[model samples]
Target: MTARFDVAVVGLGAMGSAALAFLAARGVKAIGFDAYFPAHALSSSHGDSRLIRLGYFEDPSYVPLLKRAYQNWRSLEARLRTDILTITGVLQIGAPDGKIVSGTRSSCELHGLAHEALDKAEMARRFPAFQLDDHEIGLLDPQGGYLRPEAAVMGYLKLAAEDGAVLHFGEKVTAVEPDDAGVTIVSDTGQYRVKKIVVATGSWIAELVPQLRRAAVPIRQVVAWYQPQDGFATQPQRMPCFLRDEGAEGSYFGFPAIGVDGVKIGRHAHFREPIDPNQPNPPVNEADLALLDGFIRKRVPGAAGLRVKATTCRYTMLPSEDFLLDHMPGEKNVVVASPCSGHGFKFTSVIGEILADLAIDGQTDLPIDAFSFARI
Candidate 1:
């Protein structure tokens, strides 16, 4: 059968779901399709918890965008009447001059954000769960927290449906043919024609937009959960979400034990193990466990207890480690985003709005020049 919509959003993960919700909410005839169900384990949007922080270490310019993102998350929570973000604060630890520490501090200073600069002794005395080296320091961002990614995605889809957007699950878009009038998407089930299309396909982005083949790469990432040895020491009430820069080794992140999963730990780009989106995730093995175990033992001994469990996830990475959010080059009706480099979950709310603006208005007021495809 043939179908049509004012806008068609493929890949209903964090970005697509939000984009569809915004379009429908604005009275646009919007429809969304996903290969899997909302927040399915196969996508990058569901990992139990994803870090949200205003003090962006990657770039000081992202601070403004992050500010808007925080407000949008709160807006989503109010609309859903369900808690989406759990603020546990965030402690970034590294050398005084290191990227994680210095860069985070710069963002805070530039934005005049509320934060605390703690030396190694202070971090140890205040939060005994972490074992900081003599040279390490910590920047405590009160705005740091963790987001329930699954809940956020589902909430967005729910709002989209409530606002009269068509939702399809388990239906993959097999082919996308663009012409002078609009774009035609051929799915396994049927065909859809739309004036505009938002391609937020995550790892499968390169399939639809060939230009990103060399830019966006899907990599396998491994994260592990550990039962904290100390009583409530690594719990959310005491221990906050954290990122530790191990210098040359790699930057690592973790969440305090919120639920039964215990303390979760992962490196920024785990092994940089590239994988094909059409293939299954490689099995999590001893090497993955060993890397996490070592970080916990060396940095946060309190959370170095029995290994609860571990799993593999996918990350679409750009060589620059930045987000790509501009319209597809030469295609005015198409916009694409991917490779959040493991940090895009927190910005889903705002990004959704940005994507809707791009697809509908052909431009957005948001300062997304940094994320333009031209940069790549």
Candidate 2:
């Protein structure tokens, strides 16, 4: 007998795992597939921490979605009896006129999100981890903090399985074929027939949907953890997660000391080097660390101690850098999610719910019109 699922979510990483959990919770016969196990380092969703905040400088429209995502994360935490979100606050410091500072202020005002506008002097007095230029200022979202990427993935997948959603971990989904009858999914292990399909494959989305090959390009990203200087207060209690805009030099993001890993930091899109997701990631090289080294040394010298650990991840990018979340072109039954352009792990919870809504209900009340496929 051919096993039939009402919905099949491919790629159980950040988005797929959440979608499966939501679908199963809705009592839909859902099945999820992933090439690797949940929380695996190979996937972009495995980093120990990813930031989440309400005053989204990226766009004010995303504020509503972020609010829901925060709620969903707390619910998942309660259900799993775990701490997925930790409030250390989030700080963005840059030119008062820069995208990060100005844009964040706009979103805060538009959404009435709790925030504080801090000048360089105030920023220095509060968080002395980094040196801010006189022209630069800080926008602090007190409710913002970091989320455990691995735990969230595992938690969501566990909930999905407990709710009777079939999960195929480490099974590769090689192809997707859709027709009037439904969608046919061909995997290395077996085949499946589902009424609809959601593709959340992250970096490898193009392989399953050829039409998106040029639209979704995968690039390598690097993150490194360094031991902090003794004199500096780099712990979460003293310093919040921070993003600094160096303008032409490139943007950099970092976290306070967490666990034994020390202080972690990385350049947003190091070198913009595109890579084949199927192959092993290139080792963290001197060239990769050079940019981060100079940035930290020039700005936050307190975190410029010996590098403790370094690893590479991939980001499936779109030309616009905004997320690509919508029904496939000319294929309404197929939902494609994420290539979240580097800043997406935080939205995993809400994105999953949106994917599930689009799959089962054919539409979502979420304002994703700006992320339509027509723009790509």
Candidate 3:
């Protein structure tokens, strides 16, 4: 069959939606498919918020990309005429020698980012609601806060539609075949042929592209919302998003009670339990609450009382904990764009631009060598 569009984007979450938005903005004939509707909680990019920060602790190389991401996010906000990012500042807290603390400091110093290093006493005095240990310090990124994941997904999908991109919601793509001329996609509903294909399939990535099965595995994750105590203020005005590198115990992160009454938090470490993405997520149980309760009671002052809500999400993790953004091997038109290891949501803004560039021209000026398949 002849190609029906210039590009076909699979997985309509952050990456796919953003890619379609940019591609359609450039007048490319684009079609996007999602197993469920965009912003649905079935996959990642759900929940109310995801952290976005300037001083990246993952690696210093991500600093440049993060800068572009911030700009792209704001540009999307301006065009959409809605709020996507809320700047509540971010407190990157951990032991002075911890990974997050040291890495954040290194990135800040290397990039000359605006940040303040806070000692334990200072952090306690300024952020009195958080009970920090004497050994723990903080790196405050003034340009850090949370992004509304669901809102961003829907916003981009809306803009993509306005720009003339065809989107198929609740249509699960079953197979993807790359050919010399382009790529072919088979979904439960129908079939499609396009000049290029970008796969951002999240947890179902392995099912669509079996070659990445070893490189990317979906692990179940848990996030909980807790009601605060009387004395502590969980409001956004007084509280900033925080990260705690708790050594072997695992790193924890949380946001203030902004739109919701309860403070929200999640552990950076996965449950070590891999699951079939085709199945429904396992329910949150006592074991899960027990794990987070330990941290809540010790670290966060106001979160000790009731656990209002607990939810399950998937993190398609690459073994190295980096991202995969390169084209599929020997396939000119297929791009594997998943397995961000839980930290890729913040970069979705620029990643969409890179995907559009690759889909149309087979190359991008973005420095994504770190996310190439060679490392996989």
Candidate 4:
């Protein structure tokens, strides 16, 4: 019932897949396990697409990580021979002094990234779908883009397996123990002992790490796909991906019509009754669809009345809405990365590289001090 490996990765989704891929490529003896296969709808990596932006509005500390993420994504795309990222620009829309606009501007300024600021009149003229208020403005980051979430996960895992990394699907880890002899991973199928263990169990972290469990909250998120009335013409060919902070209502965002699953849109934040990950996602209710419809009606009129399809996802939130990337306190052989807080997918490539580095060298050059467990 017990096997051995050099490194054992739990929850091989975005971050874990990347870690396995990177480790396998480096000739490290790595093995990965997942309760479900990559791109499964049950996990956070299900969405057809995810936004990747360089001008982070959350904080400037993420700028360096994002820079590395961009490069890593490109490298993965080339290695997989598939386009995992689209370089369409991104737009931050809000009041001139609002968090979306002002914070993004500050991050770009601090990092010396190339960006453009536009007033309401100019924004309306350039991107007519957005109905900005009189005092609102837009910050355009050319480096911001969209990533193919499902494709990226599959690509990483596929390449990892091809490079001699063992992947076990439909196997969920139930317990983890780490000591001087390294770590032991127990799951339904069997037990795995390795020199090191990496826990990347997205929303399931609450169940795996009891001490840090309360710090990670799982919440439901709803995303909608609408048929564009006139397709790309109404939204334009190069229309930037948009993030809008509607102040009291809530912050929302969307992407251009990519001809895959209609024009995708969703709110950036929401409140939902928590549920166990093993259970099916709750049904998408009328109010959830209404919220997305309302946003589109006011901001994206072209896609407002079109027939809409909707689905639900989950976000494992940290109190600070930052990532938890570090070694387990008092346990040197165990590393944990979780609670990407709804915004972690885009950085999975770089995060995977960093996780591999941490396991191998016990340290990373990436600026992850702000995302340590001590902060939680």
Give me the runs in candidate 2 sitting further than 4 Å from their true place: 1-3
| Model 4 lDDT per residue over 7-61, tens place | 8889888989999998888888999999888668778888778899998999998
Backbone clash pairs in model 4 (N, Cα, C under 3 Å; residues 3+ apart or in different chains), count: 0
Instruction: Give the number of the best model, judged by lDDT.
Output: 1
Residue-level lDDT of model 1, residues 1-376, one tens digit each, is 2436889999999999999999999999999999989777668987799999998889989998999999999999999999999898999998989999999999899989988988878887788888888888888999999999999999999999999999989999988887768899999998888888999899999989899888888999999999888856897888989999888988999999888878999998899989988888999998999899998998889989899889889999998888989888888888887747778999899999999999889999998999988888
TM-score of 3: 0.98
What does candidate 2's lDDT look like per residue over 1-376, in tens digits? 2537899999988989999999999999999998888767667888798988889988898898899999999999999999999999999889988988888889999988888888888987898887888888888989999999988999999999999999888899988998866888999988888899999998888898787789888899999888888435888988899888888877888889987778888888878999998899889998878877777777888878888888998877888888878888777789999759988888888998899999989899987898888887
In candidate 4, the residue pairs with backbone N, CA or C atoms under 3 Å apart (3 or more residues apart, or in different chains) clash, namely none
Q: What is the TM-score of each candidate against the true structure?
A: 0.98, 0.97, 0.98, 0.96
> What is the descending TM-score order?
1, 3, 2, 4
How does each model score on lDDT?
Answer: 0.89, 0.87, 0.88, 0.84
- TM-score computed on alpha carbons, candidate 2: 0.97
